[model samples]
Target chain A: MALLDVRDLSVTFSDHHGRRRVVDGLSYSLDAGGSLAIVGESGSGKTQSALALMGLCGPTADVGGSVRLDGRELLGLPWPALQQIRGQRIAMVFQDPMTSLNPYRRIGGQMTEMLTLRKGLSADAARTECLEMLEAVQIGDPSNRFTQFPHELSGGIRQRVMIAIALLGRPDLLVADEPTTALDVTVQAQILRLLADLRRAMGMATLLITHDLGLVAGLCDEVLVMYAGRPAEQGPVDDVFARSLHPYTRGLLHSVPRLGRDPGRAPPARLQAITGSPPAAGDAGPGCAFAPRCAYRFGPCDEKQPEFAAVAGSRRVACHLESPP
Target chain B: MTLLGVEDIDVVYPGRSRKDMPVRAVDGVSLTVDAGQTLGIVGESGCGKSSLARALIGLAPLSRGEFRLGDSIVRAGERRWPRRLREEIQMVFQDPVSALDPRMPAWQIVAEPLAIHRPELNAGQRRERSMAMLDRVGLTADLAMRYPHQFSGGQCQRIAIARALVVEPRLLICDEAVSALDVSVQAQIVNLLAGLQDELDLAILFISHDLAVVHHLSQRVAVMYLGQVVESGTREQVYGLPAHPYTRALLAAIPDPARLELPAVLDGEVPSPTDPPGGCRFRTRCPHAIALCAKSPPPAVAVNGHHAACHRRDELTRPAPG
Candidate 1:
């Protein structure tokens, strides 16, 4: 069995407006030491889905469906049971490192606190493990960094610290939400490399949630493309990127300016911009959510919502056009 | 002729105390942008690209050097900008939502420039011009009555672009303007800016950390590292054959799935501008740094009509060993 298996995962929130579903009927699985990327733009519920998996979604959100790790169901567990599993079996690294970390506490204090409380390590032993993990994340002079507060470190360093803390628990799975979005291109490369290396070294499964397709290509083995509270497509990263059946995926690929294009030749004067914006949650009517902006959208796309079905080997697309003739 | 000429411009922020060091955010940078030309400045965070953009439009005071817009000249330490000079140079910032006034309607925000620069026009005339500018930027006439919060990120950027170009400024400085936007929306705005550049013959100082975006719009490119222009050349010259190690590193760092290979990551982070290393500022992180790199600042060497400030420019640019 895979290390992490999720089926029919759904998340909804009830506000003054109405009960709006943010994630709906999403299913995927990741084997031991495998990596999966949840790719989407803003309001795509990719982040919310990951939050649901971690049991970190706040009181406002209503999450459903089965989340199993090591043949054990996680959904609807008590607060204490969930807490025991969190940061111990399944760890998470958030997008913004500054806000996630405490400004007042030194790096050593914050990391050691988690270790002592969760792993039942002594203060001295936790300190030693913290230093080792810091060095493992390629933070130079871990000893000095231990004494410094979060404010004293750079964005990249703080992110590395977050990764080290996540790994200190020796978790089986790691969920990173837009880990490199706040960083520069060079720094982003470093962080991605660090994550890839650590995942390989520790034999851990990773669920990387990001908007950048380029990131998905390098770091992930499988990909789940989300749009407007639903899974638009899911498959091996190479297959999804190379032969994307969904119009949204194709539009996303065409939108980004790539570096590999020949500098000597003139680039396409205008990019294939996806006209109109993504629909607001629950604003997507009974029909297909992407029908409004989809270039290849047809009669059925507007009349009825498409269901996620197997299209090719290990690939599933939620598009009416993907149906075999 | 160059519509905008910047010579050895330096912007320095004063120290907090006598013991503290003042930061030289932009140091001895020189470049030019001709009429209807786009000069893209590419750099990482804290490399002073935004600082340089601010200095060009007189938002930040230059500690030294000079700038010329057409025939008019503005020297360093000039606190007050003449109205004519101010009207000729406009800027579009990165954050579209925060850059605009939330309380004001979209038309009012776009027409505010006319209110400041072209007061001779009546309120009705200003409104017409604002609506026309809005239409040109792809925003419909109906959006004119809406406020910033009502518009999407891409639409807000269009409004911002409309506001900047309403005055028909000789030069437009976009400091990471499309960085906050999504990939699809970013392309739309890029195309919109390109179209406006052709229509108005406006010189653009395009500052961004994204190499691909810069290459898409720029006629010429300048690569900044630690408050200095490490390399500057025509788009083809710089992008096709980068000379400076820093520039090469920046290009190589772009996440290209087509390439599908790990980038040659730089060794260390950018040093604080306040206490930058002597000689080459990039020596700390440069893979090609040698003993000579730490001794003296690298001279700008000219090759194939391009300039790169690196002691080992030739060696770095040489063909790789078989």
Candidate 2:
């Protein structure tokens, strides 16, 4: 069995706006040492996917479907039972390190506490290993950094600290949601390098959730492009990037301002902005969700939902046009 | 005659709280732009790009030196700008969501600048003119009735662009205008800005942290560091063939999937602005820091028309201190 397997996982919520399901029928698997990146726009439900895993989804998140870790069922596991798996077996590094880390606690204290609680190591031993882990993440002067609070460090240092904290106990799976978004351009490169290194060194399977395809193009092995709480396309990074089967994925990749492309020549951009807004949850009634904004939608796309079947060249797209491949 | 002549314009942020130290936000920056040319200002965050933009548009008071919009000097406490000056210059902020009045519709937001600049216009004329300006930014006339919140990040930016252009300003100061938008949206906005710039014949003081975006858009580039122009040159000269170490570092730092890693020249956090290093401010971090660096600030080492503040100008022309 794979290290972590999520089968038809769905997440819903109820508020003043009625029942809103953020994540619907999401399924992916990862072996012991693998990296999968889920890329999407702001409201494309990438963050919720990470939250769904490790049982971090809040009370309002009405979850259904199976979440398996090392062949063990986790869907309806009690909070106490799930808590044991979370942070110990699987860890998460949130987007913003400034808010994720406790400002009051010292880095050493936070790192040591996790080691002591999860792995039952002595305080002294935990401190030693944490300092070693900090070094592994390429944090300078790890001994001094241990005593420093979250606020004392720069944005990059703090993120490295967050990564170190996540890797303290060496969890089997790691879910990093836009870990480098808040960092400066220079620091972003450093943090990404660290994540890539540690993933290889520690033999940890990782799920990197971010918006920047450029970052994923270099770092991630497999790519999942999500749209309106569902995966629109899934395949190897090079394959998906080279031949984006879905129109939305192609539009997203072209939209990003890469190093090339003269900014001066104002070409009348051909953006497939999907004429309307994202379809709301429970609104995907019997038809393709993307049909509303799809530029090339024909009669068949609007009438029925498309299957997420395999396409040619080992790729899969959840669109009617590419379903036959 | 220079269209906009600013020489040695300095802005010092006097410490408000007792504990905080005074910060020299922008210091001794001098440049002149012809009436119909765009000058792109590129720098890292906290490099005083916004402060320079604020001074150029007469929003902030100059602590020292001179600022002239044509022949007239911009004086302190003249916050209520004169009609002729107000109509000629306008500023667009980074976040259109907060910069624009959310309670009012798009037409009213664009009309606010029109009313301020051309008070003589009646409500009917304002409405007509605002819709006309909206069309220039590639926005539909129907969007005039919708609120800013209803639009996407890109559309909200178009509304902001319309607001800036509605006054028919000669110079538009865009402070990270498209930085917040998505990449695809950024290209659209960039296209819109270019079309408007050409049609209206306006000068632009484009400010941004992203070097690649600046390289893509700007005609001429000026790199700033700790409230001063560390380097200035033509777009190809500055971005393609960089003069200053800081400029090269800024360009190298931007993530480019197309280009593999170049020899990186910078490391560590941005030095604190409050207590910037004495003499050459960048010396503390500059890889080529020597004994002379702590003694005096480096003068602008001249290129053909370009300039960079570095002691070892000869070294920059070489392999750039690998």
Candidate 3:
């Protein structure tokens, strides 16, 4: 069995205006020690889908469908059961370390809380383990860092602390949502390297959520491109990024500014930007959500939502085109 | 011709208490931006590129060095910038939504610069220019009256761009202007900036942490580290054969899918600006640091029209000649 199986997952939010499904018909599976990345622009439901996985969505959110781990269903579990599963089985690290880490508490105190409470380790043992995990993340002078607050450390160090704390529970799965978006390129690279190393050492499956396609290739084995709460494409990172099938995916690939190998060559005068912005949450019509922005959009695109069907290899695409463009 | 020439610019922030030493956010850095060109300044956070931007605009304290804009030379400790100089330099900030006034409509926000600097123009003329600028930035006249909250993030950014360009500034300092926007929106804005640079012959000091975006827009590039220009050259020179260890590591760090291998990340964090390392600020994290690198700051060595501030620049680039 796969380490994680999410099938037909949907998330909706209701208000006086009525109900809108922010995430719809998302399905993917990850093997043990595998890494998968969910890439999309804002309001694509990438973050919402990950939130639905952890049951971390706000009270206004209504999540449906199935999420299974090791042959066990997790969609409708009670709060107490879900709480036990949270830090013990699946840990999460957010983008902004300053916001994620408690400012009022010391680093050592925060790191050991998970171990002492959930793992039933004594205070001394948890401290020693936390120090080791900090070292594992390659933080220098782990003892000095332990006593300091989150604000005392630099942005990179604070993020490392977050990773150390997340790994303290030694969860089988690590869900990182835009973990390096707030950091500088060099610092982001360091964080990505650390994550890759930890995954190798711990054999943990990772569900990485990010908008940058550039970031997906190195760390992730699989890629799932999301658009307006639907799966636009999915396949091996190298294969899918090498030749994206979906029109939306292609547009995104062209939109990003890449550092060309031939640096002496002049950059293109203009990026082939998708002319229109993404549809707002709950604003997608009955037809394809990305049809308005798609260059190869056709008659069938406006009439009905295309089915997510298989393409060559492990790739799947949700577009009306008869073959890959 | 050089539209802006910065010479040994420094921005130091006084500490909160006597015990805390003042932070030298921007150590003596110098560069030039030519007319109708983009000088891309790239570095990680706290590298002082933003401080340089603010110092250029007279927002930050210019502790040392002077900047030459055309024939006029503005020295450090100038209390107020000349009115004409102020109009010649405009800025577009990172967060588009928050940068705009929530209460004001898009048209007024665009015209606010005109009202401040171009007072001779009547309200109608300002409105006319505002609509034209809005159109130039891909925003429609219909949305001009709408408040910031009504527009999307991209649209708000368009409004911000309109405001900056409405006055027709010669130099536009974009400090991470597109960093907050989504990739698609960022492309639109980037294209708009490029198009405008040609149309108005604007000189842009584009500062961003993302190297790819900087590589795309800039003709000349300067790599900053802890408030100093570690390397500066044409886009082709710097991106093609980065001499400085920091520059090479930075370029290698970009997670480009076209590249086969994973990025080679530098170890350790940027030391606190309050108390930087004795000689080189980057030596703590630099992979090619030598014993001499710890004694004194490396001087800039010109290599094929590119300048790198490293003691062993030639040795590192040409470890073994062909």
Q: Give the 10-residue window scoring lowest on summed lDDT in candidate 1 chain A.
A: A259-268
Isolated chain B TM-score per model: 0.97, 0.93, 0.97
C-alpha RMSD between model 2 and the true structure: 3.3
Candidate numbers, best TM-score first, in rank order: 1, 3, 2
Better of 1 and 3 by DockQ: 3
Off by over 4 Å in 1: A322-325
Clashing pairs in 1: none
Q: By DockQ thresholds, what CAPRI class is model 3?
A: medium
Q: Write the per-residue lDDT of candidate 1 for residues B104-124, one digit (tens) a residue.
A: 999999999999899899999
What is the Å distance of residue B119 in model 3 from its true position? 1.7
The ten-residue window of minimal lDDT in model 3 chain B covers: B257-266
Q: What are the chain A TM-scores of the candidates, in order?
A: 0.98, 0.92, 0.99
- What lDDT tens digits, residue by residue, belong to model 1 across residues A22-91? 8988999999889999988888898989988778889998999999998899988889999888998999
Error of 3 at B315 (Å): 0.9
State which candidate, 2 or 3, has the greater lDDT. Answer: 3
Per-residue lDDT value at B83 in model 2:
57
Model 3 ranges off by over 4 Å:
none
